[model samples]
Target: MDLAVLRPGELTGADREVWRALQSEARALGAPQLANPFLAPEFTLAVGRCRPGVRIAVVHEGAGPVAYLPFERTALGVGRAIGLGLSDAQGVVHRPGFHWDAQELIRACGLSVLEFDHLVEGQEPFGSRKFPVFGSPVVDVDRGFDAYLRQLRARSSKFVRTTFAKERKLGRDVAPVRFVHDERDPAVLRTLMRWKSAQYRRTGRSDRFAHPWIVRLMEQLFHTRTESFTGLLSVLYAGDRPVAAHFGLRSPSVLACWFPAYDPRFARFSPGLVLHLRMAEAAAADALAYLDLGRGAKDYKNSLKTRELTVHEGMVMRRHPVALGHVARRAPVRALRHAVLARPELSGPADRLLKRVGRLRTGR
Candidate 1:
């Protein structure tokens, strides 16, 4: 096989078509992770437009392209998943049985080290280098919203009942509540971003919207609409005021959950959960199959998820000094994070500590 690297926007019209076909075929062949909108070529193209150094590696065998990898390169010869830190699904979009040496791929990309988190499963070579695996929760809505509700109620009847009760009370206490599954208004998008930014700082996490590129990328994605990839902004409103909102990406079969936040004033109403339930209903109505909640441990995920998917995180490296230096700086941090995540006992304390730090950061 031969590898050709080019910017994501450099793919010819025919090549883009072929890329979509490859992704669809891969999904049918049992790699459902390919269904993630984040793995779509359009996503790469959007990121390429907003961020510099975004490239796509096309792998060709004999007469045609068989796989693609979208990544970002840095000046120091370091590489990362395209939209790394933001993208929840990362890996090569390859044919079912294609395989390559991890180090060889790294060399071909002209990088000494390639790093990724939330790397999709079934990715060999790189999977061999993974530090730990995390469970990404997903809501299976293929059988329609009603069926999913039945399953959810079966799993946590009280949680479902209480959430529904809160939704009704939210309507009565605030205003008549309503949900909009596909909101096109840009103003509401900005509102969601502001809420998300405040949420990040409040939780002692880096605010993603503080970066110009991430903000520009989301704006670009908001206008992106296609069969393989579409930006979906769903909102739960009390009368005319949006109580909670979510902006995620969707392919025909799967909706990859991304940014979700709600007005802090509505915290008691559980607006976030209410928004997710409505989003799932809308996704099912749109004939989508799954709502990928992304890899994270949160109470809402535990309450709503129908099942879990495994995603790995780590690096693929070549024998270079840059690679060694990158590993030395990152491995310990990654190890500590995984250790904490693996044990609820440790995770609770860590969370509490972070919140305390958050309070200080927010001057509260």
Candidate 2:
């Protein structure tokens, strides 16, 4: 096998087509999670447009391309999964039974360390090095949204009852509730960024929109539409006033839920939940099979998810000083996180502490 690394933008038209074909083959071969639009070449190109460090390693065996790994590399030789924090799915998209030396790939990419937070399952070498695996919540709508609703109702009837009740109350008290599944309006996208930024600050999290590149990336994706990978913006409105919105990426079979936020003034109405339900319905109607809620522990995800997909997090490092340094620097924090996640008892207190810190940070 021969490996070559190039900027995401440098991928030829043929390369992009081959990459998509590989992803499609993987999805068809029973790894439906490979359908995630985040893993699509378009997403890598989009991020590459904004981030100069973005590169892809293409491995060819004999006559054809067999594998592709998209990643971002810093000047200091630290590599990250493409789009890193923003991308929920990470790893190489390759043919069945393909394998490569992790260290060899790293050196070829000129990377000392390759880090991934949401590496999809079945990724060997890296999967072997993964920390405690985490379940990314998923809503399986293969049989359609109605079937999912029936299952959800059977599992969490009160949650469904209460959320829909809030939706009704919101429509009655504010205005008639309406939902737009694929909103094309740029103004609504701007509104979503504002709401999401405020939400981040309120929750003691770094605001992704504060970074110019991420903002630019979002704008680029909003206008990006293709058969296999398209940016979807769903908004829930009370008459003319938008209450909640979600901006995510979708392929033919899977919708990868990303940024979701709501107007705080409408919090009492639980507009976020209302928007999610509507999004799920729209996803099913679009013939999508799964709505990947991303790897996170949240009440809404728990209530709506029919099952969970396993995603790993870890690093692939070459034998180098920088690799050792990177691991040492990150180990403590990673260990603490794994410990907390392993013990449900630590999760609540950790979350409450973060919220309290957020209050202090925001002076609320």
Candidate 3:
């Protein structure tokens, strides 16, 4: 086996060809196409757009690419997989039966420790040593929106009825109902960013929209379309003005919900809920199998989820003394970070601080 760390521009044509071949294998093995983007050269470029330290590891056996890991080197010899917070499914892009160990990969890359926040379940080469297990909710829209709603009502009757009531009242008082599943309007994207940023501040979380690269990436993704995955901007309009919008990715069988926001000015209309309902309807019409709400425990997610899927993340440290020392020092710091941020009490204050910091940094 030959292993080497590759810089951003060092990705060769052979590398991309091998990558596409491996992606076919991954799809054959039942991996979702969303996982394919993490392995794509374009995605590597996008992450580089946000963080310049992005690196790629190409693992080869007898001149054929076996696995690819896209990561970023941070300060203090720390490394993280590319698109940690943003990616729904995180893992190495590899063919099945590939048996490289995580610790060995870390050592090969000459890294002290490798950390990932959204590592996909069942893809961990290091096994159970990884910490922090969480589940993401998904809604199956295969049969259709009405079928999905029927399942939801059967599972959580009151919740569905209540949300539907809110939707009805919203339409009655606000304006006639309007939903665009694949809206290409840039204004809807802008509305989503504004609402998402406000929600982040209101809840004491770091506003992802505050990042210029993230904003730019969303803009770029909105215009680009691919067979396996394409950008989707779903919007609900009230009297020709968008009241709620969701920006997400759609593969043939799944809609990976990302940023969703509604106008606070029309809060009484429950536009967010209305938008989700419409999205579900659209997903069913599109013959998509699932709507991934991503990792989080929001009331809406709980109410809409037909099932939950587990995901995990952890650090894999090389056995070297330097790596061990770094892990020893940083583990507690990471724990503290999670502790402080995870607490409900700190959420509001943390969001406020992040918003203030974001404003200072961006002057927005």
Clashes of 2: 0
Give lDDT tens digits, candidate 3, residues 1-364.
Answer: 4897898789888886677666655544776543434445556666676677888898988758888888888655677778777877666877777887777787787678887776766575756345788788888787888888889888878877877788777677877777889998787788789988887766556789888888988887787676655788999887688888999876656778888988888887677887888899888888777788888778788878888867676778766666678678868987876776589888667657876776665556
RMSD of 3: 3.9
* Superposed model 1: Cα runs more than 4 Å off: none
Task: Name every residue pair that clashes in candidate 2.
Answer: none
What residue pairs clash in candidate 1, if any at all?
Answer: none
List the candidate numbers ranked by TM-score, top first: 1, 2, 3
Q: What is the lDDT of residue 235 in candidate 1?
A: 96
How well is each residue in 79-189 modelled by candidate 1, as lDDT tens digits?
Answer: 999888899999988877889888888899899999999899878778544457889999999999999999998888999899999999998899999999999999999
Best by the lDDT measure = 1
Best to worst by lDDT, what's the order? 1, 2, 3
**Model 2 per-residue lDDT tens digits across residues 156-200:** 899999999999999889999999999999999999999999888
Error of 1 at 247 (Å): 0.5
lDDT of 1: 0.90
